[model samples]
Target: MKKRFLGYPNWWGEMPMAVYTFIEKHDWEGRTIVPFCTHEGSGLSGTERRIQSACTGAKVLKGLAVRGSAAQHEQESVRKSVSSWLEKLHL
Candidate 1:
């Protein structure tokens, strides 16, 4: 993985718009974007698709969505899950 990151401001039920705005404000051509998030219950919620559509020139990978509660109370499990996800992606 290269030393690059794209961080977007997100809110529940607002990820699609946020991603669109992010894409509009930035240039992600020829880059691989991995989206990850912590949500209460709406896991990913088609945000991956939105991201792909918004950033048409970038490759959007399958993302990991952690439940906010699980992340808060099951730190070790979250860590393991994230590690596994990254490993699967060969990152």
Candidate 2:
């Protein structure tokens, strides 16, 4: 976390514990962090806001929260959601 990731500009994937730990321990002065999460029904659990608060000076783009089951049973829907989110973030 304190160590820079160097060439990376952004982070993705369901907000894994490792990412949470990294954010908590790091100072993302010039980076952008996106925290997405998958759940049974509970959504992001506020990790996005928390991430923004934790990573000072970082550009924390809006996060994505999707249900875990959707990926297995509704692939196209998940694809659309991801596509839209990426577009909205201009990523």
Candidate 3:
């Protein structure tokens, strides 16, 4: 058997339609989903719930939201934040 991982996404405009469509098209049962995104200000406003609603059988972990400006201009800090978040989850 093999394992797969989906990299973090960029959340925008309250609900990211592509992410929603991806979720809707796939079978997420028996999987772990950790949602992290960068946004201008929406800041993961409704994506977590959207993901939950779409993939009911998957385990959705707490999501991390970083400002889009920070993600673009503050690479080191974003890296640190992601590293710290992963550590906390023991990933």
Candidate 4:
């Protein structure tokens, strides 16, 4: 027997196909899709746009960008933002 990685080992490399499938699957879901991305410096990196194109019927909200290192300290901000967005969207 050989050792094999069950999940995608190179997620970034497969992101395009993954995004396409995600978009196709969620296109008809009548809910807002909010993305929160943690990056070293690149921020959301246009992921919101990609998600918007993928999720046709859902309104993709402006995503939050938090430094991966700073995520622990950003708990309050994340909570507040999500709460505000949910309230605004009435979701």
Q: Which candidate is the best by lDDT?
A: 1
lDDT of each: 0.75, 0.66, 0.73, 0.55
Model 1 per-residue lDDT at 29: 79
- Measured over all alpha carbons after superposition, the RMSD of each candidate to the real structure, in angstroms, is 2.6, 6.6, 2.8, 9.9
Where does candidate 4 have its weakest 10-residue lDDT segment? 1-10
Candidate 1, residues 41-76: lDDT per residue as tens digits? Answer: 778777788877877588888888888789889999
Candidate 3 Cα deviation (angstroms), residue 14: 2.0
Which stretches of model 1 miss by more than 4 angstroms? 1-13, 16-19
Which regions of candidate 2 are displaced past 4 Å?
A: 1-17
Off by over 4 Å in 3: 1-13
Error of 1 at 37 (Å): 0.9
Q: Which candidate achieves the best TM-score against the true structure? A: 1
Q: Give the TM-score comparing model 3 with the true structure, all chains together.
A: 0.81
TM-score against truth, every candidate: 0.82, 0.72, 0.81, 0.55
Q: Tell me the tens digit of each residue's lDDT in model 3 across 1-91.
A: 1222443445454555766677788888888788787778777776777777788688777778888799889999999998998888667
